[model samples]
Target: MPDPHSSDAEPRPAHSAPSSLLSRIKALLRPAPPADREGIRAVLEAAHDHSILDGESYAMISGALEVADKTVADIMVSRSRMDLLDVSLSLTEQMRTIIETGHSRFPVYEGDRDNIIGVLLAKDLLLTLSDHALDIRALIRPPVFIPESKRLNELLHQFRISRNHLAIVIDEHGGICGLVTMEDVLEQIVGDIEDEFDDEDEKTIFRTGDNSWRAMGTTEIEDFNDVFHVQLPDEDYDTLNGWLAAELGHIPRRGEHFQSQGLTFTVVGADGKRARWLHVQRVSGASSSPETHTP
Candidate 1:
């Protein structure tokens, strides 16, 4: 029989020893560097340069960092663009709106959009179709209200804990300002998350003819400038529509044309108030101006 505690016994393998204690000790001894935003950005940029992060991943990391600074108001769908359902509307009417918008959820309002009562999930309507007597109120889940000034990162954490996807943004006066969704928050990080409803081939801005182009209202001003090879001041507003509206001092109606900065902007398609599609034609040999105009 082998003698117990014998020195002659086969030595334990060098690699078999637990290294967690040493690792912990080493970690404790190493000085931790301060992690400021700039430091974090430098690290991320370095990682991107080393091919450890792809372009998309790098952008997302930057966006995540940005989320800490941005408030819900920065990314929320403005009240004007919100597709709200009136609880008083017929079920069929509500269903029609749901189909037209291609949105999965809608804020259910009472008399006005500001007086939001609850949220309506499109899937919840399926059960009510069989029984007309079924209470639509029962289908509405409790709505989540958030302040416009709420930091997006904090909101994301709250969303995770509550398992709620949508939030109604309110102002200091407690009036509904707009609505925010998990998708909206995520888009800030992942760029646009196009779904089946989105047209993959759709162009936000397209050249129509020589020195002429067509742009969607929602097109980003930066993208427009890049495409047109012209500098359009993007300080006050982000979207072409918003810039046009600001210049006009109100939303322009269809057929309204305005010229400024050596370009003619015509509202080719509009929805009574807001310009939906704009036709832009650059004036031949026209000198550009530093100002935006509504004339």
Candidate 2:
């Protein structure tokens, strides 16, 4: 009873067939409902077995681990950079420097600046008369010294075990070269550890060399320029090192030196792609050179 010549009686169109095929393909591609834990584990193992931390995070952890292997020379503020009090000073003079520097502790040195007596607490001084005759031998706490090559983690453990916050880092000859505090170690773990004494406007900076400093990677280009007195012409890069590299057209190396404006930039450390630490000094004047040692 059907009309065979009519289109309605003919086969379906190619376009219509393709639509049906597409729906079937989509259904096949759809994800399977999540299975039981064991089944999921099997699927995960089958898919891939190795995926851990990615690029940036891995670098951060590696850098921190490197801290453990580094000697105190890698991080310690050298004696030249230290703000210390001479024990021979009239008690009034010692108190004055303390108030100016806002330092709670000072390394007491004798006749030769190299000879360290002991660590003195400012609060102890505050309790006594500044004009009173002082005997550093009586008030002194025992000096804590560690080899420059000790691992930071080991040093930290020593700090905890000994209940000591201050330590003098010594060279092979037993000469005092630098000092480290509990706060310095804590900063590595927690990042930019600040105290009530730290200035709000000041950023945490590491002196990378005699003439340069390494700043936090996140620092702004403007802030970097202001801090270092560099006149980097390009507005493109955010860090001083980034600007330097862009200007030089290559990554800088250790002992490689450059200058701009009134500042001298010397590479002290690096991690291939970027400058890790830079030693900066003002060209207008020279400060007394501090003795450096390889631990």
Best prediction by lDDT: 1
Off by over 4 Å in 1: 1-34, 132-135, 196-295
Question: What tens-digit string does per-residue lDDT give for candidate 1 at 1-295?
Answer: 8886898898766755468678888999996663799888988898899999999889999999999989998878767667788888778667655654456788998887788889988888776786765556778989999999999999999999999889999999998888899987887788766543434256677665667776777788898888878777799989888988888888876556777677888775454346666778888877777444543
Report the lDDT tens digits of candidate 2 across residue range 243-278: 767656677554556666666565544434665555
Per-candidate TM-scores read 0.58, 0.49
| Model 1: ten consecutive residues of lowest lDDT | 193-202
Error of 2 at 264 (Å): 19
Q: What value of lDDT does candidate 2 attain over all alpha carbons?
A: 0.64
Instruction: Pick out the ten consecutive residues of candidate 2 with the lowest summed lDDT.
Output: 286-295
